[model samples]
Target: MRRSFRVLLCLAATAVGLTTLSAPANAAAHNYVALGDSYSSGVGTGGTYSGGGCKRSTNAYPQLWANTHAPASFNFAACSGATTTDVLNSQLGSLTARTTLVTISIGGNDAGFVDVITTCTLGSDSTCVNRVEQGKTFARNTLPARLDNVYSAIRQRSPSARVVVLGYPRFYKVPGSCNVGLSDTKRSAINSGADVLAQVTAQRAAAAGFTFVDIRGAWTGHEICSGDWWLNSLTWPVEESYHPNKNGQARGYLPALNAVTG
Candidate 1:
């Protein structure tokens, strides 16, 4: 009887060890998908990826977020010029039951960020201001609905996955002594629009039962004119303009990190 009992104990321990070893192998087969725009794609920040040209970068924020927090089986579907709708119709097809995480940073392009830049560089004063205000309205009104659709589709596709909605950082600084070509009134208008955008995104996050990672606060002192700005100034030193650089991407990661794990 003692010998029989010893044999049974050994069999049970072997079974447990096999289960433990297989668990990681099973998990390794799962997936994670990242969906968003250039901010998520890591353009201009460096770290080129194969096959994506400049649209996708290995060092982008979502990839950074994934490296820091995601499961091992994740794929970044972020493109530089992707709009909110692009995420739902294209990026989401990559997800399956094995998918476990989805992170997004969108709505900027849909709100006419491209037009803002293009029109500003070429248009006259009235045309620029008018275009900016028009874009602001679109961002405030149309973007939330687009975000809602994308968020909902992601939830439907990957029911068990963790979703993260990342907010945009403050682009312009508050009015101060060092006013660049852009006026304080214009800056205030832009900031107000951005604030509204953040608010709506937060609301969408709550509705979808996902985490809303606010990048604005972490970017407070890192605006364009600050000595240690995360993003480069839009008006000068041409190589760095209108987007987050390495410092900005690095700084932006903190809020995302705090949101997912905290």
Candidate 2:
């Protein structure tokens, strides 16, 4: 009876070892390429950056996903302040026929988000409102064609890639509890512009047959005005301002990407 019991244990252990050894062989190895602007590059996350001045942080969603998923190859091609043209000219070179996945967030900069924020921060209520309207107009009228160009290029280069197009979050929470920042009017206008950008980007992405992830809903109660801010508020060094913080990348964007990727 003792010998039989020992043989059973050995057999079970051997089976478990074989299962462990085979798991890696069955795991799919994906070729992933990340592209976009500051949001995708992770400017406000405050970790080490690569790709020269691209500011691609270790905490960014792409890196974080790669760390966990162990894709066959990860090309972090995203750059700070990248416009749609920038992606078309510079970023798409990393993507190829073998690229299994691609993720990006763009169009905000093309719509002049940085200038809008700067004007809203320093100028009077009227200036802020007007600037926000102009941004909305640009997003609605001009951004679709630019987005079409980028999406078309992505589809052309990486024909089989599962492309995930992420949109910007609303920068502020209107009627928020915070008292020290700009008036509710400015905050509301900023959100309206963000909505326009999201709408236009979503339409274009869908037309291109890509998955569109609207981060605005995921980032609710965590904008610049919230007590627990996922986005920075009028930060110094200029680039970090209006960008997402670490939690925003890890908790917010990461999960949003994971939901679709998984």
Candidate 3:
């Protein structure tokens, strides 16, 4: 009777130990890495994230997704003021064979979208047009190759990872009523420039066989001139100006990403 009782105790202990080892509640399996510029880094969103000057946001889409889904590893490599070359040199290091998911929004800084916007907001109409034209020329002639390089690097790093490329939203609402911040001429020029940039970005993203989310479409009624704006207009912190606010990341960007990822 004593030997039988001892054997039963040992069996129960082994079963409990195995169950604990095998059934960890929070064990992660998927690896997700986010790479890009201020938009991806969440600079426009209030409150900063880790990673030095990258200015990543806890409220950014990548972090929001990871917060709920809880991937095995989440690397937020996107940085503020990051260009395609910056990404190639700095951000790609976070990727590896284990990376299963990646997201990026690049090329805007390469074309100097912010500078063009500044020119439009403060300078004369023709100045804005000329600046915008310059930006469009760069987008057409140079941005495609730069985008291709970034996409190629992403592919090489994470061959099987699902890469989602998101594009910038148009800044102004055409025929909008407010008429306060920028002139109609400037607004139209900016919008048309955005269209050109999106076209180039979408083309390169498609060529890479990656998913491209058009936040322009997602943010139609919520642009800078709309009554309920997702993007910030000219404001303090200067960098946050023209960038998406917290609501933009949560509602505009996050939902756009989710629709594709799901």
Candidate number achieving the greatest lDDT relative to the actual structure = 2
> Candidate 1, which segments miss by more than 4 Å at Cα?
1-30, 47-54, 120-129, 176-180, 235-240
Q: Give lDDT tens digits, candidate 2, residues 59-125.
A: 9998899988898999999999999999999999999999989999999889998899889888988
Off by over 4 Å in 2: 1-28
Pick out the ten consecutive residues of candidate 1 with the lowest summed lDDT.
Answer: 23-32
Clashing pairs in 1: 42-60
lDDT of 1 by residue, 97-213 (tens): 667777788888888876775665566656767877887778668777888898888888889887878888777777544645666655565566577778888987888899888
How many residue pairs clash (N, CA or C atoms closer than 3 angstroms) in each of the candidate models, in the order given?
1, 0, 0
Question: Can you rank all candidates by lDDT, best first?
Answer: 2, 3, 1
| Total clashing pairs in model 1 | 1
Which stretches of model 3 miss by more than 4 angstroms? 1-28
Global lDDT of model 3: 0.89
Return the TM-score for candidate 3, rounded to 2 decimals: 0.87
How many clashing pairs in candidate 2?
0
